[model samples]
Target: MNVSINIKWPLIILLMLPFTLAIGCLIQIKHFAPEPLILKKDEIFTLPSGTNYAGLEKLLRRQHLAKKTCWLPWLIKLEPKLAEVKAGTYRLQPGMTVRDLLNLLVSGKEAQFSIQFIEGERLKEWLTVLSRAPYMKHDLHDVTPQTLGVKLGDPADSILEGEFYPDTYLYTATTSDSAILKRARQRMKLMLLKIWEGRAEGLPYETPQELLIMASIVEKETAIKEERARVASVFINRLRAGMKLQTDPTVIYGISEDYHNSITRRDLMTPTPYNTYIINGLPPTPIAMPGQASLKAAAHPEESEYLYFVADGRGGHVFSTNLASHNQAVRKYRQGHDIRGNNE
Candidate 1:
């Protein structure tokens, strides 16, 4: 009987050994799961592509985010979902626990970044903004106006100015520059189509492109919300009367990179496709990006006989129906500057 009891006791001890170790590991995991990590502030963590659970564990240990412990491996083994971590940039907040971090990694919600394309800015300026943005992939190294226009199904010689909408766009890390530009372009197209369909009747514009050109001019003319429609009316009246749309913004755009801060007489007289002083109608292309308000104003201009406008020396403009009145207003505000009837 004593020998039999001794053999039974040994068997019982062997059976209980794994259970005891498992209980100890469970206690360690519970303790580590809720404890705050050793982070003082927000931290940006990047998990490289093709990284697995074991690799992440090693990285956590190396970064001192987690203590070197054997129980972590046991926790991972118990929760198989923890092994599935998505590769992307993540922002880890303070007081986050191991469980929270694991959930975030497996959820695949990467940190988002934003880039803004502003109104009245040129495409070159927008490209510069994209190039300086953080975490963006510079895929536009060989991009030009001609190549980009062709890629967007426009003619190879098509001008890409004012084709993209000016707005803030959000994207994940490593988003290509071309991707953002394409989205902006699509948005602009949709918005332009919508506005063109709802355009007011009897406007001088023959095509949506011509309306876009006028909108770009209005956007550059006055930032005042009330003045946009009035400004559009002036250009439309000029187009109807066969008079020159003598705007300074077009002259500046014609001068291109060589334009100084102020427009000179030489720039006004120089013959270029964009120089409204020389051109009889709208410029061949838009000078800058136009926002929704300007586009809408171009589509639906105010009913007015104003043929000219000059800066009021304030933030607004003085509109006139005749060149004599326009010259008088220009002389009143401009004082000693050129006696040009249009806003310079």
Candidate 2:
């Protein structure tokens, strides 16, 4: 039996038309069934934190921001990266494809407002600026230095003050208040770890944690880079001799708003643990986020017996070993230049 060129091939092909159309219809439904209303640049999706994929899809579809929220899971099942979308306030531009939108979410390229923490400014000013920033999810009313320690699973008094080193930070439109605090804390922890790993021998601080605490005090005492080591040394000597640290920053740190600003001679007498004149040891916690230099100072103090330090009207302080020499140095160098006597 020989096979002939199939004269029934045309009929077989014709019979398959209905099946082909059915498959086409099924695909159309599977891929793009519900068309979404177009979105413009002015259109905004105020996405909240903790939004799961299913919750987000329904919301987007309802607002006409998505073509079919139902298909999101299936698409992610094909490409699992889609489910890893970050939560942020997303502004939609008109005519953006679903794929493009998903790519933005996966990349976490959300819109942000910038907040800069400047050097020399105290924590009060820093907190004020941060509280007014946009997209913050935390309550500023509850963001005192004392409160931060509590959030970190410590007692209210255990939190460090004024020590979050000044630096630039990036934040999303609706980042929580605690999240921002967490970032500053994380920075402090990182700097301490790095400095501790490379510390100098013969320093007084035994552990990285103690070093950080002392550095926090030194950081608040002086912003001058060259003076940091000497300032650190004074505290070290005080610690060795069983004397009060008597540092101004610590007293200022313990005081409330009225007490922190415009510190007076009497403020030092306040019966607070942070008032180093009264407290014999380190404060309950780190005073602030100490910078690398301050941390280094804590680790590598100057080899001097200087028991006295006074601001020299410049950005630095003058150090001396004895009262007569310190007074003489003060007369020669700091005369007529508005020097403030740091009560030791």
Please give, for residues 1-344, the per-residue lDDT of candidate 2 as tens digits. Answer: 12344756777888998999878755654565234336756555566678777776787777877765676766666667777888777656776667767777777777765678765455666777877886666565756655656765667677455446567888777677557766876787777788888887776677777887888888778988988898989988878878788788778777856573578978977788778889877887776666778888998898889888877666677787777987877786655453335432
Would you give me the overall lDDT of model 2?
Answer: 0.73
Predict model 1's lDDT versus the native: 0.88
lDDT (CA) per prediction:
0.88, 0.73
The true-versus-predicted C-alpha distance at residue 223 of model 2, in Å, is 2.1
| TM-score, model 2 to reference | 0.62
Collision count for each candidate, in order: 0, 11
TM-score of each: 0.88, 0.62
For candidate 1, lDDT tens digit of each residue in 71-143? Answer: 5667788888887889998888898998888889999998888999999998878878887888877877766
RMSD of 1: 4.4
Error of 2 at 113 (Å): 3.0
